[model samples]
Structures are given as C-alpha cells and as structure tokens.
Target: MNALAAQALISARRALHQRGELAVRVAFYAIILVIFSALWSAAAGANGGSISGYDAHSLLWYVAAAEGSVIATKPRMIESIGWDISSGAIVTEMLRPASVVGLRLAAELGEALVRLVCSLAVGGVIVWLYVGQPPSAAGIALFVPASFLAVGCNLAAQHAFAGAAFWLRDARSTWFLYQKLVFLLGGMLLPLEFLPTALADVARALPFASMAYVPARLASGHVEPWLLLVQAAWLAGLLACAGGVFWAGERRLEVVGG
Candidate 1:
C-alpha cells in the first residue's frame, strides 16, 4: 500500500483506540443490553410470558445481537465528515494527492473493525450470561461475513448521508431524520417481523434491514443461507450507490469561508 493509505490506516486505528473509547463503547453496549433485558422481562410478566414469538430470554438475545451489531460499527462517519467540513480541514484534504473519500472510507473501516472486536468480546460474554448460550458455532461463523456485509452497507448509507453536508452546510435536520428512520426501519427497536405486513415488506426491500435485522436474524437462526446471499448483494449495491453519491458530491463541492 502507498504511504497515504498507510497513514490513513494508522490514523484510523489511533482514533479508535484513543482514550479508552473502545472500553467505553463496550460498556455502553452492555448497559443497553441490561436495560433491554429488564424491560423485556417486565413486559413478559405483564403479557403472560410471550410477545410475538419471543419470551424474555429470546427477546433479550435479539436485543443483544442487534446492539452488538450496531455498536460494532462506526455510525458517526457523517458527523466526522461534517466536522471536517466545518473546521476547514476539508480544504487541505482536497488538496492531497490521495482521494479524500477513499482515505475516509479506509479510516472508517479500520475504526469499525476495532469497535467490532471490542463489542464482540465484551458484549458476547454478557449476552451468553443473561440472554442464553451464545449463538452456536455455526451461527458465530456465519456472523463473520454477515457482519462484514452489514457494516459495509451501513457505512455506505452513513457516508451518503454525510455527503449531503457538502450541499446543506448544516445537515443536522437531515441527519436526525435519517437516524430516526434507521432506528425504525432497521429493526433496532423491534424486529421487522412485528411490523405491519406492508411496513415489513418495505423494510425488507430497503437497505436498512441488512444493517441490523439480517445479521441479528442470522445470529438467532431465523434466516436461510439463500437470504444471506441476498444481504450480500444488497451490501454491494449500496456501496456502489454510496460511492456514486460521494463522487458527485465531490464534483459539486464548494468550500465556503476559508
């Protein structure tokens, strides 16, 4: 690899590992899992021990899988992109021989990998203890590729959203709306299975499902091998689309004020 790529990788790794962020992030995931488990337990007791084919244990496990998958990835690439723009660092970035987009992409991937390792190590143990046995060996094996696809799709989506910063200058509203949609459509709060048929159909067709739902479903043994292939295809397609958007945004770039 070239020096710029190497430097970007190093920077990404440093950013992820700095100030014990990995530990803090893992703790956050664990705390969320605890809260989710308690809520599920309370709901199960009130509802006579089942809600939508999942008891407290299964629900907790599902939440754990979802949380782990989410915490494992870097979802704040847009915010970073925005900060880079606002700070005028982007001007210097654009002057580099390397592709700014490519550098950011590599950095984000490195950061995501670091986060994924920390989450799986800490969060996996918590899930096993409270939720149940960890996903089976086969399920764990499947999660490797499933997670790669999921994170790729998620980063692509996030970068595409961040690219809007180039045009909007202040994209807080857009980012908030996009995040809320992800929470709902990505099945982070509830599995798509529980949604109305029409909504669930839409969710499945969108890229959001590949982020949390597909991997979580695979972790829970709810998906078929064929479905895994479909998720991979979605990841590829989303990445391509994100790349196109980033390129177009770069071409249209106008740096305001310094």
Candidate 2:
C-alpha cells in the first residue's frame, strides 16, 4: 500500500513537470468544451430555448461537467498497457509489486487525479462565465464523488481491455473500438438523453453511462440517488473484470516461461 502511494505521488510530480504537454492538452480540453457549448446553445435557440430538460445555460454546464471527467485520462491507457505487456515490461513491473496491474493503476491514478482537477477547474470557469451560475451547492457537492467514480470506472474498463494484448500482441485496434464505445455509449460528447431511446436504455444498462453521463447529469441538478448506486455497482464489476484479465495474463506468462 505504501509503495502504491509513493508510485502515485511520483507519477503525479512527473506529470506536473511536463508543463508544455499538459498545457496543450488542457487547452484542447477547453476548446472542445467551448465548441460543444456553442453548438448546444445554438440548438437551444433554434428550438424553444430548451430541449429534453436542458436549457442553453444548463446544457453548457452539462457539457463542461461531462467532458471534464471524460477528458481527464491517459489518452493511450489501453495501448500503453498493451505495449508494456508485448515488450515484456509488465514482467519486470511484476517484481516491484505483487501485481503489475495494481502498480500501473496506482501510477495512472496519481497522474489522472491531477489532470482531473485541472480539467474540472477549466470547465467550471468556462461554464460559470458563459452560463452565469454553476449547479446548486448540493449538486456541486455530489459531483466530486460522482466524477471520481466516473474516472475509476473508465480506468478499470480500459485496463481490462488492455489485457487483449496478452493474446493478440497488439491493443491499438482494441483501443480504437473501445474509445468509440465510450464516445458513444459513455456519452462523452453528449448526454445519454440525446441518444435514441433504445440506445439510451442500452447505455444506461451498460457501464459506459456510469463513466460520464451519471456525474454530468447529477451536476446539472437532476440528481438521482440511484445513479450513484449504479456507478458503484459498475465500478465493482469492472474492477473484477480487470483483475481477472490480468490474473489470467500473468498465468499465461508463467506457463510460457516468460
């Protein structure tokens, strides 16, 4: 546990020092938020000034919240994990921790938490200036837990997907497909409500919605206690899936005399 914590801190500091790259990513994050907010605002204007329980102001805020957590991630999490496995780095990492997966997760978490804070700060400022006011105090309070779970669930799923590298020797294609799934089913660009009725239902049933939509929706002031429960359940399930995949991968390596 202490080792994991130290790894997280070291990763965080390393990420913090890469000011140029982090600045560019945060700028890109800000730009995407602005573009989406504008598009939603125009749509609302063309309609009756609101659509599907979302007005221009609230819609902007929603996009900010949704994308904030969604964008606060390692861009090549799955692909990098795959590369580590294929290059035999995972084997070396296994010597440092009882499980390579736990160490990698700890490192990623440290880096991601910093990025999450920066992304959320940019998002909050954008929405506040454009929309005039943020969500209610209670909604703001709940957003932290909801968004934390959102990030956790996403990372867990990515780790599970990365296990494909153990067998396939490549995770790029898998990463591509998984990203699209998150972009659609996870509602990274838009809320689940924007999806078709059937599609929305499926998204809700899956873990994807727990990644972005739940926290975003809650931050928009339509807090539902049940959605948090849904996020918790999915987090548990995805963590299990990740653990299972890595456990099997380790066994595979051992059997192969790696």
Candidate 3:
C-alpha cells in the first residue's frame, strides 16, 4: 500500500513537471469554453428562451463543467498499456508483487488530480467571470465525488481498450474511437438533456454518461442522487471487465525479440 502510494505521488509529480503541456491544455480549455459560451448563447436566442431548461447562464456553467471534466481526465493509460503490451515491457511488471493495473491506476489518479485542479481553476474562473453566480452548495458537494468517479471510470474503460493490444497489434484506433464516443455521447460537447429523449436515455444507460454527463448535470443543479449509484455501479463493472482482460492477456502474452 505504501509503495503504491509512493508510485502515485511520483507519477503525479512527473505529470506536474510537464508545465508546458499543462499550460497549452489550459489555454485550449479557456478557448473552448469561450467558443461554446458564444454558440450556446446564440442558440438560446434563436430558441426564444432556454433550451432543455438551460438558460444562457446555466448553459455556460454546463459547458464549463463538461469541459472541466474532460480537461481533468487523462487517458494516457490506454496508450501506455498498449505500448507496454506491444513492446513486451509489461512482462517485467507482471512479475512484480504489485498488480500492474493497480499501480497504473494509482499513478493515473495522481496525475489526474493535478489536471483536475488546473481544469477546475480555469473553468471556475470563466464561469465566475461570465455567470457571476456560484454553483449551488449541494451541487458542488455532489459534483466532486461524481467527477472523481468519472475519472476512474474513464481510466478503467481505457485500460480495457488497451487490453486489445493482446489481439490487435495496436489499440490506438480503438482508444480513439472510444474517446470520440465519450465526447459525443457522454455529453462532453453537448448536454444529454438537449438530445432527443430516446438518445438521452440511451446515453444515461451507458457508462460514458457517468463519466461526464452525470457530473455536469449535478453541477448544473440537477439533483439526482441516484446518478451517483449508477456511476458507482458502472465503475465497478468497468474495473471487473478491465481486470479480466488483463488477467487473460497476461497468461497468453509472448515476447519474440529483445
């Protein structure tokens, strides 16, 4: 446990050391928030009122929350797993006493914490500057846990996708497609409430929604305590699936060359 914690801290420190990368991502986060605020404002005007119960202010807050979740999520675990599997570097870790998935997840959590802070800072500032009202106290309380679970869910999902490297030479394309699905269906760019009723229901049923949509919804004052249960269930399921994939993959793993 202590070793895992140490590894997490080291990984987080390493992630924070990439200050240039963080700055660029923060800049992009601000840009996207501004652009979406403008677009949603226009859409609200055309609709003659709020769209799906979201006025311009709430909509901007929604965008900020959604974008902040994405910014906070670091999906590098997929690429790292895929590369390790392909290069046979994972074999070394497999021989260790600690579980590879556990270590990687711990590390990812550390790295994600740093990004989450940076993202929320940027998004919160923008929301404050534009909307001028703080999110509901209850909403903030609920959102923090939901957002953390969302990050964990994403990491588990990516690890599962990374396991595909055992069968496919590279899993980058799968990861890419999965990410796009999250971006679209998970309410990263647009809230699920704005979607057609059927589509929104489907999104809610899927784990992707738990990743971004649920947290954003909570932050926007949609108080649904049940959503946290849904997120927890999805996170558990994803972890089980990912664990199974890695367990099976490791048993059949082979290294051909030095």
Candidate 4:
C-alpha cells in the first residue's frame, strides 16, 4: 500500500511536469464545450423551451459534466500496458515488490486526478460563460465519490481489454472498440435520458453507463442512490474480471529476448 502511494505520487509529479501538454489539452476541452453549448442552444431553440427533460442551460451543464468525465480519464492504461508487454518492460516491473496491476492502477489514478482537476477547471469556465451557474454544491459532493468509482471502473475495463496485448501483441483494436462503445453508449455526447427507453435501458445495464452517464447525472442534481449502488456493483465485478485477466495474461507472458 505504501509503495502504491509512492508510485501514485511519482506519477502525479510526472503529470505535473507535463504542464505544457496539459495546458493545450485544457484549451481543447474549453473549445469542445463551447461547441457543444452552441449546438445544444440551437436544438433547444428549435424544439421549444427544452429538448427532452433538459432545458438549454441544464443540458449544457449535463454535457459539461459528461465531457469533463471523458476528459478526466483518457484510458492511457491500455497503451501503457501494451507498450510494457511489447518492450519487455513488464519483466522489470514484475521484479518490484508490488503488484504490477495495482501499481499501474495507482499511477493511472494519479494521472486521472490531475486530469480531472484541469478538465473541471476548464469546464467550470465554459459553464459560467454559457450557463452562468455552477452545479449544485450538494450535487458536486455526491458526484465526487461516484466519479472516483467511475475512474476505478474504467481502469478495470481497460485492464481487462489491455490484457489482450499479451496475446495479440497490440491492443489498439480493442481500445478503439471500447472507445466507440463509450462514446455511443456511455453518454459522452448526449445524456442517456435522451435515448430511446429501450436503448437507454440496455446501455444502463452495461459498464459504460456507470462511467459517464451515472456520474454526470449525479453531478447535474439527479440524485439516485440506486445508480450509485449499481456502479459499485459494476466496479466490484470489473475488478474481479481484471484480476482474472491479469493472472491469465501473466501466465502466458513470454519474452523472446532481453
């Protein structure tokens, strides 16, 4: 545990050292939010006071929450794992007195924490400019835990997918597929409430919804304890699945040369 904390701090400092890149990423976040705000405003105007359950203002906020969640965790774990496998770095990591998966997860959590702050800061500015108000304090408080759990859920899913690199020698295809699933079913571009009832129910049953939709909804003042409970369940299941994959992948690991 102590070693994991130290690794997390090291990763956080590494992210801090990449401040220039983070600044550029934050700029892109602001631009995307602005574009979404305009599109939502036009749609709301065309449809009347509100489109679905969200007014223009609340819709923008919802989107901000959703986009912020997306930006916060960029799924770099897959690429990192793939690289470690292909480059034989996993062997070196295995020698360390720590669980490789746990260490990487802690590091990713550190990176995600830093990204979440930067994204939220940029998102907060855009929300103020376009929506003119902050999310409810109570809502933000509730969202913090859910969002953290969402991060863990995301890591588990990514680790499970990335474990394929041990066999495929590359996990880019898996990552791409997962990205599309998250974009379409995780409510990155639109709230699940806006989806057809049947479609929304299907998506809700999947892990993707727990990452983006549930957290965003909670942040937008939609309190649902059942959603949080479901997210926790998903987290536990995903973690177990990840651990199983890790064990299998490690067993299959073979290095051809130094």
Candidate 5:
C-alpha cells in the first residue's frame, strides 16, 4: 500500500490505543453482558424449561457473538465526519495527498478491529464464566465468513451515513437515530426469528440483518448454508451502494466555514 494508506492505518491504530475512552467502552460492553446474563438466567429458570429454544450455553454464545459483531462494526465514521466538520479540519484533510474517504475508511477499520479484539476478550471471559465455552470448532469456522461480511456491511452503512455530513451542517441527530434503528432492527438484543413473520421478512430483506443477525444466527447454527450466500450477496450490494453514496457526496462537496 501507499504511504498515505499506511499512515492512515498507523494513525487510526494509535488513536484507538491511546484514547482514554477505550477503558470506558470496554467496561460498557462487559457491564452489558453481565446484566443480560443475569436477566436471561433468571428468565430461563423461571420458565422451567428452555427459553426461545436456547439453553444457557447457546444463549450466552449468541450474546458474545452478537456483541462482538456490534463492537466490530460501530459507526466511528459518523463521529469522525462530525468532528472534521465542526472543527473545520475537512479543509486541511482535503488538501492532503490521500483520498479523504480512503484514509477514513482505513483508520476506522483499524479502530474497529481494535475494539473487536477487546470486546471478544472481555466478553468471551464473561460468557465462559457464566455460560461456558462456545460451540465446536466447526461452528466457529462456519461463522468466520459470515462475521467478516457482517463487519463489512456495518462499515459500509456507517460510511454511507457519514457521507450525509457533506450536505447537513449537523448530522448528529441523524446519526443517533440510525444507531438506534440498527441495533433494534438488526436484532442485536433478540433474534429476528422471534419477530412476527412479516416483520422478520422485512428485517431479513434489509441490509441491517447482515450486520449482526445473520452472523449471530450463523454462529448459532440457525441459518442454512444457502442463506449464508444470500447474506453475502446483500453485503456486497450494500457496499456498492455505500461506495456510490460516498462518490456522489464527494462530487458535490464544498467545505463550509465552521
């Protein structure tokens, strides 16, 4: 890769490593897992039987995989774009030799990878202690491709949202709304299978499913291999659409005074 891309990756990695907020973010994920584990265990016991076809082990594994995927695909792009706009840093960045989108993409990917590692380590421990080990090695191997596609789709969706900063002076509200919708519709907290048939159909059709639901479902062995290919296709389509949005935004771009 060129020096610009290399520098972007270095800078992104450094930013995530040195940021004081890293601890807080890790703690947040751990706390969430603990809370959910307690709640799920209580409910499972009360039900006097399996809860939603999930034993404690399966439920915990699903939680770990789902949370890991979320951390892996967070919308750091929106935050970066907002900061650049508000501080008038876009002008300086635009003058650099690197492509702004390319640099941001590299940087955000680095950050996401860092967060994923931390989340998996911390979350994995929590799940192990409370629930037990994950599924067999084969199951984990099957999840690999789906997990990568999920992360890719997440990055594309976030960048697409961030591209809106080109026109809007303040995109924070939109960003917040998008995050909420993604978490809910993507089935981060509950499997989409639990949704009504019509709702589940719509959710599956949207790119959101490729973010968390599909990967988690695959990890849980709930999804068929044929459906895995469908998920990959959806991810590919979304990435293309996101690229088009980025190009269009760049074409119309004019950096306004902060």
Candidate 6:
C-alpha cells in the first residue's frame, strides 16, 4: 500500500512537470464547458428558462460540475494498459512488488486527481461567472468524496476493459465504446433525470451513473448522502471485477509468454 501511494505521488509529480500540456488541457476543458453552457442557456431560454427543474443558471452549474469532475485530458487507462501489454512492457511491471493493475491504477489516480482539481478550479470560476455564485458550501464539500468514488468506479471499469488486451492485444475499441457510455449513461452532458423514466431507471441500475452522475449531482447541490452509498457499492463491485479480470489476464500472459 505504501509503495502504491508512493508511485501515485511520483506519477502525479511527473504529470505536474508537463506544465504546457496541463495548460492546454485546462484550456480545452474550459472551452468545452463554455460552449455547452451557452447551448444549454439558449435551449432553456427557448423553453421558458427551465427544463426538468433545471433553469439556465442551474444547467450551467451542472455542466460545470459534471465536466470538471471529468475532463482528464490524458491517456485513458485502457490505452495505456493496452499499450503496456502489447509492447511487452507488462512483463517488467509484473516483476514489481505491487500488483500490476493496482500499481497502474494508483499512478493513474494520482495524475487524474491532480488534473481533476485543476479542471474543477477553472470550471468552477466559469460557472460562477455564469450563475453569479458558486455551488453551495455543503455541495462543494460533499463533492470531494463523491468525485473520488466516481473516479474509483471509472478506473476500475477501464482496468477491467483493458484486461481484454491479454487476448486482443488492443483495448482501444473498448475504450471508445466506454467513452460514449460515459457521455450518455454517465451523464456527462446532462442529468440522468432528463432521460426517459424507464431508461433513467435502467441507467441508474447500471454502473455508469456511479461514474459521473453521482458526483455531478452532489456538486450541483443535490445533497443526498445516500447517493454516495450507491456509488460506493458500484465502486466495490467494479474493483472486484477489475481485479478478477486482470488476474486472469496475468495468468494468460504468463502461460502464453507475452
């Protein structure tokens, strides 16, 4: 555990050294939020300034929070792990003291957490300009844990998907499919409440909601603490699944001489 934490910190520090890259990423994140916020405002104005209980102001805040919590703007874990496995790099990582997947996850989380904070800071200011206020203090405070849970669930899912590389030699296609799921089912663009009732119910029952919607809702001032419980449940299950898949992949690689 200490080793994993140390690796995470090291990776985060390394990521910070890429200042120019980080600047571009943060700028792009801001641009996306601004554009989407404007579109939402226009749509809301055309529809009496509120849709599904979200006014233009509220929608902008929601978009800000949601996009901030996401927008990593780095290599997705699926591609990274896929590359490692395909290039025979996993062989060296397998010899490390920590579990391969755990180590990779820690490093990814470290960098992602740093990026998330930076993106959210910029995004928060943009939304504040739009709405004339920041998210509620309670909302901002609870968003911390909610965002962590969201990242946990997301990374676990990606790890599980990457395990397919043990056989397919590339998981990038899976990553693409997962991105769409996050954009829609994960509620990156809008709240799941806007979806049809039956579809919303199904989406909630799935693991995607725990990835983005749960944190975004919390950040947008929906202080339902129980939402974190659901996120936690999904995180636990996804983590287990990721572990199982990666372990199986490791076995396959070992037997097949990757």
The true-structure Cα RMSD of candidate 3 reads 2.0
lDDT tens per residue, model 4, 120-155:
877977787877775567776777787777777887
Go through the candidates in order and give the C-alpha RMSD of each one to the true structure. 2.7, 1.3, 2.0, 2.1, 2.8, 1.5
TM-score of structure candidate 1? 0.87
Which prediction has more favorable TM-score, 2 or 3?
2
Off by over 4 Å in 3: 75-77, 254-258
lDDT by residue for model 5 (1-258), tens: 896468657965785766676777788889888887887677767887457777666666777777788876555557777667555677677677766666766666677767777777888788888866666555666666767667767876777777767667566756677776667788778777667889888988888887788767766646456656876787677667666765666566563334
Quote the positional error of residue 21 for candidate 1 in Å. 1.8
TM-score of each: 0.87, 0.96, 0.93, 0.92, 0.85, 0.95
As a whole number from 0 to 100, the lDDT of residue 176 in candidate 5 is 73
Model 6 deviation from the true structure expressed as Cα RMSD, one decimal place: 1.5
Which structure among the candidates has the greatest TM-score? 2
Positional deviation of 88 in candidate 6, in angstroms? 2.2
Q: Residue by residue across 140-252, what tens digits does model 6's lDDT show? A: 67778988788778888888878888888977667788788888988988799999999889888989888778888877777788988999999899889988988998898
Q: Which 10 successive residues of model 5 have the least lDDT summed?
A: 249-258
Show the lowest summed lDDT stretch of 10 residues, model 2: 93-102
The residue pairs in collision within model 6 are: none
Candidate 5: residue 146 lDDT (0-100): 69
Using lDDT as the measure, name the better of candidate 1 and candidate 2.
2
> Which ten residues in a row are the worst by lDDT in model 1?
249-258
- lDDT-wise, the better of 1 and 4 is 4
Candidate 5: list runs displaced more than 4 Å: 3-8, 73-79, 83-88, 226-228, 254-258
Off by over 4 Å in 6: 73-75
**Residue runs of model 1 more than 4 Å from their true location after superposition:** 2-8, 86-88, 254-258
**lDDT values for all models:** 0.72, 0.84, 0.82, 0.79, 0.71, 0.82
Task: Find the 10 residues in a row with the least total lDDT in model 6.
Answer: 68-77
| Full-model lDDT, candidate 4 | 0.79
